[model samples]
Target: MSENTADVTETATEGQQQPIELPADHPLVKTLAAQKESIKELKVRAARADELEDAQKTESEKTADRIAKAESEAASVPSKVADALRTHLVALHGIEAEDAELFLTANDPELLQKQVDRLVGQSGKRKKSNFVPREGNTSTAGASDERSFVRDFFSGN
Candidate 1:
């Protein structure tokens, strides 16, 4: 019975010592306690805002990368189209390689043909190289004597 009484008194003393009161005298503590709910709400809102900002940055970077890739591809399109046009003119139209550039800017077939004729006429004005062997050197073995066998091989004998 005495031990039970002592335990009851100790519990009462501990309960008395533990006061469920805020530090009312401290202004800062009182303010923080008063605004605790609002502070949590603000923190949550701030975190959400930061998350949204980071997401926007990520999306913007991705968009910028996509735009950069598109710009690069766009820049090369003209050259690719020009090369295809040059190939078509050279293979199908029998335009000279040196005169291909002049026809690239021409829109219609008639204009392109006119440019081709102009280029052919200009080519006629230039003197031809005398590299062609004379009729006397028609023999293949004799032509080999005039030029090196390697040069003849490379020149498509």
Candidate 2:
């Protein structure tokens, strides 16, 4: 009996840390306790509201909701695919991601390529030394480039 009592007390002590005592008369403590109680009440009310709303929903209404959600997700797939393609094209063309996002909005990769090619072909501001390297020997290759090379696509000659 004494051993069991000792085990119980040990467990209780283990569960507790030393308390940081604040005066109960403190206005901040009072407000904090009030807020805690208010949170509990609000949580209860929200749960009850959800339960009532769920109870009010018919089987058909739930099915319709699921269908609508699925439809919305389905509608977004093309946009996601196009965005992925755009990102790939941006990296491939050595165009800045921000520049592509701002200047290129077309869904067609070929069209976006043309747009990027035009931007690269037009802008003579970018120096040979300023080429953003993509693949091997780009620095050595771009350093001797004639002119008209885009960001960094100096493969042969």
Candidate 3:
């Protein structure tokens, strides 16, 4: 009975000596406790914003890549079409082989035709409406009178 009482007294003394430490006065502990909730909320919002930015960046890159590929394909089409157009134009222009080769190598057909037409018109071969002489400027009576004079001069009686 005395041993049990002594053990009980010792346990009670230990419990009394080991006071429960309440976190009421530590500034760092208080700050950390207060910041924990806000930090978790901030982290969640930041993660969401980062995810949205990543998704937007990925979409933009895909669109850019698609546009670049389309442009490359489009560029190739014009070269091939231009080559076919050159062949057809070379035949239609009736140009000498060497000159046609030079023209096809150097210029587009429609552009060459425009240049040729411009130069040809400028070469004075084209008829001008204002420069053409009038046909019936002299009267028929004047011509007849001139003819009688010529007949009299030629046939002396």
Candidate 4:
């Protein structure tokens, strides 16, 4: 017999006939036939994975940027409220613009008003002394002294 027939007979005697013909038209067979095509398919899969990773990275960066911007805006709100209070005080008090600005910037108005009221109540019960009245006609010397005292007291000088 021929060599091919002899090998087939030997394989048949071994209880199995494993077919070795290449089916060039079969989808799986065709895929395995071209090494360059297989490599190209693998590269395409790798590129898809890289694209997914880069998309996730860009999304995370946008989320982080939004969070940072929100935090910055939230931090400025209190300062904006404080500035509004200062402007209101300057407009309402008929005070020296600088003095109103300083008072609003330096102290809580509600707390300062409570303290001043308490001091005024205490002064009403006491006899007049060197302390200048909040509203009264006074000598020029007395006015200068009171101004100097107020300036020195506020400045801690």
The C-alpha RMSD of each candidate to the native structure, in angstroms, is 22.0, 17.9, 25.6, 23.9
Per-residue lDDT of model 3, residues 30-113, tens digit only = 887889989999999999998987687877787897999999997787567666776665566554567556544524546655
Task: Identify the leading candidate in terms of lDDT.
Answer: 2
List, in order, the clash count of every candidate structure.
0, 0, 0, 0
lDDT of 4 at 117: 47
Taking the tens digit of each residue's C-alpha lDDT, what string does model 1 give over 1-157? 4665576678688776542333457666678777998899999999999898767787778789899999999888766665565567677766655558544465445555566667667767895777756756555565555478677789997
Query: Model 2 compared with the native: what TM-score?
Result: 0.47
Candidate 4 residue lDDT tens string, 68-150: 99999988876766566656655554445554444434345465455444544554677567876666865556467778888
Which sequence of candidate numbers ranks them by lDDT, best first? 2, 1, 3, 4
Model 4 misplacement above 4 A: 1-57, 106-157
Better of 2 and 4 by lDDT: 2
Ranking by TM-score: 2, 3, 4, 1
Report the number of the highest-TM-score candidate: 2
Q: Which ten residues in a row have the lowest lDDT in candidate 1?
A: 16-25
TM-score of every candidate: 0.31, 0.47, 0.35, 0.32
Candidate 3, poorest ten consecutive residues by summed lDDT: 115-124
Candidate 2 residue runs with Cα over 4 Å from true position: 1-22, 26-28, 96-98, 106-157
